[model samples]
Target: MHNRYSLKEMFFEHLTRFSAILVLFFLSAIFIVLIIKAYPAIHHFGFSFITEQKWAPNFELFGGLPAIYGSFISTLIAMLFAIPVAIGIAIFLSEIAPKSLKSPIGVSIELLAAIPSVVYGMWGLFYLAPFMRDVFGGNGLGLFTAGLILAIMILPFISAITRDALNTTPKILKESAYALGATQWDVIKDIMIPYAKAGIVGSVILALGRAFGETMAVTFVMGNAHQIPSSIFEPATSIPSTLANEFSEVDSELYLSSLYLLALILFIISFIIIAFAKFYFLKNRVKRKKRLV
Candidate 1:
């Protein structure tokens, strides 16, 4: 026997396909436009554009190394500070917190995520920056400050998603483990985490992509210096910070093209990281599910 779709089903299916194709088309168009805008700098600098450190616009010199380095270092610091704390918060909310305390804490976390990025930037500039400067003895508007702001900005997203993931654990499984003399920690470590690994990983990857592309928050506190910072507390710049700080001041074609190149680089890095997580982890998860079946 052959199966046939109704008219509405076919129309909806085709519409969905068209929507997916439209998204791909827009992404390709954006990449093509960036390449076209960045071609001059690509031709002028060749591979050296990525390695050279100088960024003087007056001399027509431009390099992306410092910006790239700052982006990497700041994101690294953010993940270092954020991941453990986010996980702890998730665990507390999911398994440890009393029912009386959960809703208020959960709402507070959602409120943190609700605040604007620019507001986080301003708060970092006025409050966190000075506090850190007093404690660490530096200007405090650098990679470290930018990284902390990013950590705070991303914390709510990671914790909320992770808590939801943990909550998906089957009650039967947890009860059985408890009956078998498993402690709460053991059940959490051995069951809930393994069961919700995919969602947890996806949430972390989502936060990571955000950290890489975050603009206003980093721009306000990253110091926007074009040179490599010798210390984490010294001035630095990331691709987004640099683009925001100088995109309007371009008096030369090379300078503008170089900025476009920086944007393209940021886009490519975020795309690759997200694609890897989506493809690799999802495929492995599917295989694991099949095995269980």
Candidate 2:
């Protein structure tokens, strides 16, 4: 029995290590390919490719500023709308829901996350875009619409992670707070949130990453206008949306390389955000541990 257990553990350990190596290999390959493919545009355009606003491919004037601006604004809008609603849902599901309803609600939210991005895109294009245009005015297919769609798409991921984090709190903590005459809101605000702050922050970062890289859904509604949006209601194009819309049609090597550069930029931004979140979480955790000691 001892020998069998040891063999099983060794097998799994090796399997896990193999999986990790495979993932690392793939990530390195992607980064290398992007760098190689994007070098032409980088060499030709230099810093202006990212700084200038115009994207007139016909005029050989290509810049990523508008796409980058659109991506940031849309992601900001999504985070603003999604974060509060996700937290509320997570709180209700984890702390307030009745036992009978909790599982169903949680499952429903998870199901939402499982829906494909293209389906969301179709729904947004057919149903949501028209609603926005008819009701609010403007073209409707713009930054605001893209942001709204992304918010809905990312909500389930944030909420599910937050719910799990909140659920990890010790029951004793809540009971002790209650014994101390603390209200439910007080317990949640002061104790629960602080306890799960790192996990919550991580979840937000993940959601932001998703919002930033989202392609199909944003493409359907973002109007694919390669210009800086003057307002939320104006048409715009995100990096992902631009790549999706133009990658197939690119006849110029420079244009193709520029798209690759955009991909690299998106990847770098996500990596930086995740790295920052991890650093912040670790620093806070160390501070808390010192306080406890």
Best by TM-score: 1
> Each model's TM-score, in the order given?
0.92, 0.89
Superposed on all Cα atoms, model 2 deviates from the true structure by an RMSD in Å of 3.7
Q: Estimate, for each residue in 1-293, the C-alpha lDDT of model 2 and write its tens digit.
A: 99999999999999999999999999999999999999998998999888989998897778999999999999999999999999999999988999999999999999999999999999999999999999889878899999999999999999999999898889999899999999999999988998888889988997898899999989999998888877888889999999999999998888899999999999999888878877877888799799999
Name the regions of candidate 1 deviating beyond 4 angstroms: 1-20
> In model 2, which regions exceed 4 Å deviation?
1-20, 278-293
What TM-score number comes out for model 1? 0.92
- Residue-wise lDDT of candidate 1 within 1-293, one digit each (tens)? 12345777888999999999999999999999999999999999989999999999989999999999999999999999999999999999999999999999998998889889999999999999999899887888899999999999999999999999899899999999999999999999999999888888888988898999999999999888988988999889999999999999889999999999999999999998889768756887788889999
Pairs in clash, predicted candidate 1: none
Can you give the lDDT of residue 40 in candidate 1? 98
